[model samples]
Target: MIRITKSIISIFLLLSCFTTVVRAADFKPLPQWMKTAVFYQIYPQSFKDTNGDGIGDIQGIIEKLDYVKWLGCNVIWLNPCFESAFQDAGYDVINFYKVAHRYGTNDDLKRLFDEAHKRKMKVCLDLVAGHTSIESSWFKASQKNEKNAYSDRYIWTNDSTIKPEKFVSGKFERNGTYMKNFFDCQPALNYGYGQPDPKCPWEEPVTAEGPQSTRKELMNIMDYWMEMGCDGFRVDMAGSLVKKDPDLKETTNLWAEIRTHFQDKFPEGILLAEWGKPQQAIKVGFMMDFIIHLRNSGYDTMFFNKTGTYRRDTCYFDIKGNGSPDFFIKNLTTQLCAAGNDGYICIPTANHDFQRPCCGERNTVPQLKTVMTFLMNLPGIPLVYYGDEIGMRFIDGLPNKEGSQLTKGNRAGSRTPMQWDSSDNAGFSSGNNSSLYLPIDPSASRPTVEQEKKDPSSLLLFTKELIALRGKYAALGNRGEIKFLQSKDNQYPLIYERRLGKEAFIIVINPSGKDVSVSLDYDRVVQKVFPVLNSSKHKIIDYKNKQLKISAEPLSYGIFQIY
Candidate 1:
């Protein structure tokens, strides 16, 4: 009897261990579609104006669906098209259930989803989950003198006169001050606090009825859209939901619960967080998080760092090539190590909030080609910001539109209308130039799709080739294993290998104006080397013993298959 009981106990232990592993994997499994997704981020108001109103709309995007597919992006991350006051662009969401009038009606969005699906692509809407426009019905209801269901939906102090940091008072019948997430016109929706302070009696726990209801409403909003053919959501300010969560423990738990429900209902649905910390965001429920310019992740050291904005004037992708890859590599390595297989780290050429790679000094075709190579070959989802494929210049000195100017800098420059052709208003809109959403690039030589499609060496063609190459190679994709082949002596010519099973490819990028050679001490013996893609005119590659020698020209890049 003792021996039988021991055997049964051992069996139970093993079963329990197996269950734990299975559950853990189930909780945070990366969706299959996200594995190979190449995203095109469109700022809706700037993409294309089909209505002649100078504002881009759903029908306009629907018209450009083929153009996006032709560019090789399978997924479209559309900025918020929901009903909004447009104080902070479209981010100040007013009604979660309705589409913005400027963009189009609900049926137009449905048609967009259908059209995209017809072309074998998916669309992800930007979800402004953290806050709502001050004009939203929920906020209006919450501000009443009498208590209502939404009274506690937002964080409010007990006394109207008491305004804390990031809190606003006045112009309300309510006896308390409300919290603001970003702009003054936006009021934060409460998801509760991590540790409710005793001094702040208004602070509620996550389990409070108000917080619980808010979570349910958020889920409802997601469900409403998913039921309407939406594939997923790119949540804006995903990490800021739970207040005062130092380590984001409670916030993480909140997302974990939401993800559980989200996956159960729509297993294919993905959540892309705007949060810069991929390590923590992926640990929670997000399938992807952006490594943007906001977190000081040294991403700026590569492409976007303005002269005095960062530690160095020269970025890794600059024409002068005075920058070091060490800073960028270190931060990327840390994020990749921490994130592991849980999710992917999304890297963008430049989002709507920052300067494009074609800005300032790094605007040449060779320089842009090197940037595209590095971005496309990396082990993450490459987000091609609208107008970036053709090297659209970020027009400086543009007046702020819809609160595009912030404390850091004015983002109006990057939010200009897309330059489709050299025609009137760059083919963005037929309206008067002054009445357009933003001014078109005034430069006579500004690159455009109409012109680039006819040129073999245009940045647009290079970007397209890079995307196609990434699609053709499983090793060059997100799930592939990346091994940086950097030695102290070869830092300038950044080298890395992407491998999947038996296939492997080495990428070399030299972002400098001078020629460079690097001898990499790799363990594998190179039986043969085929240049898959080469930006350099010379085919300078040799292998001796276990060492591999590669020579690259100024502002050059190459992808080689190894046998």
Candidate 2:
């Protein structure tokens, strides 16, 4: 028994070493442009209007390319401009090849691409790979009782008698019911499940002819967009492509195949996954994956958590909040270690699916600045939502517009029209107020880019400064190595070090409502201190004894460069 135990231990150690070596060798370099690229997510419907149509169009985005450039974002991620049925917004894609008429024509989108390229900026469109609208031509052909070329494009059970759970049935003349990915308007495409049950003849394997054809069609769609000068796609629900993928090995393999082919044709083109599991997504050749709000992946605890409410959550960046950094740090560290040099873990301020940073109780400039500091200085690509820089509040209790219905919360609050100015409809539209996409913020004190751009102390200017700082310092970019130096003690402050080769910088944040002092080991001479909003309130009281005493006021942050 003792001999067996020793042998098992030896095998375990050998496997551990082998795994580490394999992971190190398997690292795939991300696209050259992504290393320093800052992404700005644009919700086109609410961005701007050019024709007084009350809806933002492709021309609107084209006209505002300068504004996006001024915001310091090199990459623009447009949320689903594809032709859709608008049931789940653009997620219910009806035509993959055409741009939505509400936005513009195919030529208009192409012009937007050319305009963006002229500014030396890249664009990534949202690709919904897992599903399509029930109204799509493919689905129309699929619903027919007669067999056809596109019959196997979507998932269907054996017969109408055998109804599958969580699926829609009886609406089509086809013998079987089709599976739904999200809303009933969207039907899941048949990529084939990883595991096929013998009893279920409809459960196709990944290698089957039908699934292989689906994969080819998806590639064709990607190829069509790539030829149009689009940089790449921010794939939606990337992990859900292959149903019943228990370990996600099949899904990973599927993406791996696509990556292998995609890289050959478009070397500069990159793929960003919305998959929250970066560990698996990176392994499967995705250049980057988002650490989204789904599954409480520490993102919720950091900024979205609301304190003293029925929700009973704490937001770490809130001034009067009691949120902890332990949860966020642990998850972030694990993901970073796993990612290594393979890909980035994008940290977004907020997305269309969630509330903005300046929402609810955390609407102060100090809170916004501190949060932006943390996002900009972190070791990943920083994604800023459209209106977040101007401190747009997530307007609550707005009725659902463009399928923003979800049980978690009203996403309409976050999808409100971008406040461009203080003019009628906040300058987002010229059409009648009743025809606007979503009503502009009704609050008299609603923030606007025009108002904030004039104020030196506004969140917009502060955000611009932070973006400029990130661009100026290599140690603060996504490629930098991060180390959490002092975050265990909640009373002290949140501190971390970012190192890029020989360059190093220390970042400190005091989110509490009280003054806090922390000791740091900084024997070397301190370089210039970047002036944040409240830098005057932070100071180094003592520099002797090889230990530096740093004091920060409530809801303040500072970045210290080290020689």
Candidate 3:
């Protein structure tokens, strides 16, 4: 009887373990399409104008769909196109349901969705959930003295006499002042605080009636777009909701609930967060998140540091720069472990909020090529900001347009109009130059896609080759495992191996102005040396004694397929 009981107990334990493993594995299956997707982020104001309105619109995006497809990106992350006052550059949304007049009607955007789908591509629109413009009907209704359904839609103090810091007052006839998420024109939506203060009766908890209703409305807004063929949303300031929560637990729970409902209805729908903390965001059920320029998540060390003016002393991308990859590698490893196999960590070349790869000191074609090599081969999803492929320079010292002025210098330079050719307004618009969204790069050497397309050895062509290489190798795709190989020397050349099941590939990059070599215990035979642009100087020195010696020229990179 004792022996029989022991056997049954062991069997029950095994079954319990098996169930736990299965449940954990099924936490959230990442969308298969996202595993190998290359994202292109389009700043609608500067991408391309079709109707000579000087501002890029949905029809313009449709016109440039072929151009995006040619660049090898399978997904598009378009910036905010909702009706807005253009304060904070469309981040201040005025209406949740209406399309901005400057962009086009709702039908035009839907047509873009249809056209993108025909080309086998996906589109994710920017969803700003934390705040709304002062012109928003919700905000306007909340501002009225009389009580209404929208009165509690925004964060407001109870007493009309007290004005909070970083909040707007006097404009609203309501009893209390409202908080601002970003610019003064943008008011924070009341998602409710994690811990409500007893003294402040107006500080509602997450479980309050108003907060619950707000969550429902947010979900409804998402449903409306998902039904229109939108693939998903790249949530703006995703972590900013659920105020007064230092730990972000309440915010995470809020997103998790939303994600659960969203996935149930649209299983393939992707949710990407702007939150820099991947560890927190991934756990909250986000499919992916970016290491944006908002904070120093080791991204600034590899690219241009915006804290200072253009200088060769700062960025790792520049040949003469003194920047190091140690910081980036350290932060990335932590984020990768936190994300595990559940979500992706996106590394962007340059977003609308930061300087491009060819900006500042890293303005040379060879330097740009080396940077592109690193970007395309990284283990995460690669995001190419609209004009970055052709090496667009950030025009410095332009007047602020659409609330480009922020605490971190004016972003007007990075928000300049896209350069298509040398035509009037750089082919961005036929409208008057004064009416253009932002001034074009005035340099005589401004790089244009039309001119670069004719040149076989241009940066544009090189970017295309890198994209092709990434697609050709399964090991270089988003789901592949990456291991950083130790370099014989300190910093010049960085080596890493990418493995996907049975197949493995090695990538070596030298982002310096001098030649560098590394020795590795790679005894396998080199099947192929994938051609890298401007890397003709790279060569395999020796592969004997169970050790391989490889050298790369200044600003060059190489990929070796091993067998």
Clashing residue pairs in candidate 3 are: none
| Tens-place lDDT digits, model 3, residues 1-563 | 99999999999889965653353345557788987799999998787777776787788789989999998998999999999998788999998888899899999989999999999999999999999999888889998889889888888888767776767776568678888898888888889999888887778999987788898999999999999999999999898889888766688679878887888889888999999878768877788988756556877778775432232347666576366788788888888898888899998988877777777656788888888888888887988998889988777777778887767577777777778877765655466643445656455778888989998888899888888878888888887778777553557677778889877877777788877677778656664444433365546444666676768777777777666
* Pairwise TM-score winner, candidates 2 and 3: 2
Clashes of each: 0, 0, 0
Predicted structure 2: lDDT: 0.81
Regions of candidate 1 where Cα sits further than 4 Å from its true position: 1-24, 307-312, 432-436, 441-443
Winner of 1 and 3 under lDDT: 1
At residue 372, candidate 2 shows an lDDT of: 86
Per-model TM-score versus the true fold = 0.93, 0.92, 0.91
Model 1 weakest lDDT span, ten residues long: 304-313
Error of 3 at 85 (Å): 0.6
* Candidate RMSDs in order: 5.0, 3.3, 5.4
lDDT of 3 at 193: 94
User: Sorted on lDDT, highest at the top, how do the candidates line up?
Assistant: 1, 2, 3
Per-candidate Cα lDDT values, in order, are: 0.85, 0.81, 0.80
Candidate 3 structure, TM-score to reference: 0.91
Error of 1 at 264 (Å): 1.4
Ranking by TM-score: 1, 2, 3
Q: Candidate 2: minimum summed lDDT over ten consecutive residues — where?
A: 305-314
